[model samples]
Target: MKFLIDNWYLVLTAVISGGLLLWTSLRGKSAGVTTTEAVRLLNREKGVLIDVSEPEEFAQGHAVGARNVPLKLLSTGEPVKQLPTNKALPLVLMCKTGARAGRAAGMLRQQGYTQVVAVAGGLAAWREASLPVEKSAA
Candidate 1:
């Protein structure tokens, strides 16, 4: 069309922008839960919070009641001894930001975890929400 040809730059920009938006939305949808939703799952569905930080980082501070299972362990593709054997239990994963947790969630899903979600914004978001956090005694 004449109008599209005349404004090809604008049309291209719009198309690229739309593609980026669609990609982000689709990528984000199934990968994470907000702090509030994480809390609801923990309280209402008895979800287990799994912190994927390294031992040193986890001991610094982590979500209260969160169990530490380093990302390295999960990456090995072997059974993580620290993880609960009941895959039916909802597992909420968190890390410093959300990146590691997202990868960890995907790994867990591959392992047949029926209900797994990463905490959006991870532990930083949890702290931002003023949720309880505790340092390891060791």
Candidate 2:
């Protein structure tokens, strides 16, 4: 008790840090999969690579064969027209930095997508892996 009292700030910091980690885990956010796993899903499961970046961002550079489905359309809570009709099909999502893809993954999971996953590092990681990328006009 005396030690804790002397180091009250340390205890409080530890508590806050632990609480944040617990909250994040309890919220069911995915830690996301590596680029290698994403590729395996794409090749083995015939997963669709859905780039959640906006059209302009996607046009700048994106994974080869990735279909554009902006996060805005997904966040509306309505059925996304661009998604595959077969909900059971694997869906691999990515964005510029992966944050939007994570949010999009949660949204898709709520919509009954059984095999949805986000790339851990998004396009940057994909590029780092020397994966193919394509560019287009917006």
| Predictions: Cα RMSD each | 2.2, 3.9
Model 1 clash pairs are none
Q: Can you write out model 2's per-residue Cα lDDT over 1-138, one digit (the tens) per residue?
A: 999999999999999999999999865446688999999999999999999999999999999999999999998889877899899999999999899999999999999999999998899999999999999874
TM value for model 1 = 0.84
Highest TM-score: which candidate? 1
Q: List ranges where model 1 is wrong by over 4 Å.
A: 1-20
Each model's TM-score? 0.84, 0.78
**Whole-structure CA lDDT of model 2:** 0.93
Cα shift from native, residue 103, model 1 (Å): 0.9
lDDT of each: 0.94, 0.93
Question: Which digits, one per residue and each the tens of the lDDT, describe model 1 over residues 15-87?
Answer: 9999999999988886699999999999999999999999999999999999999999999999987898999
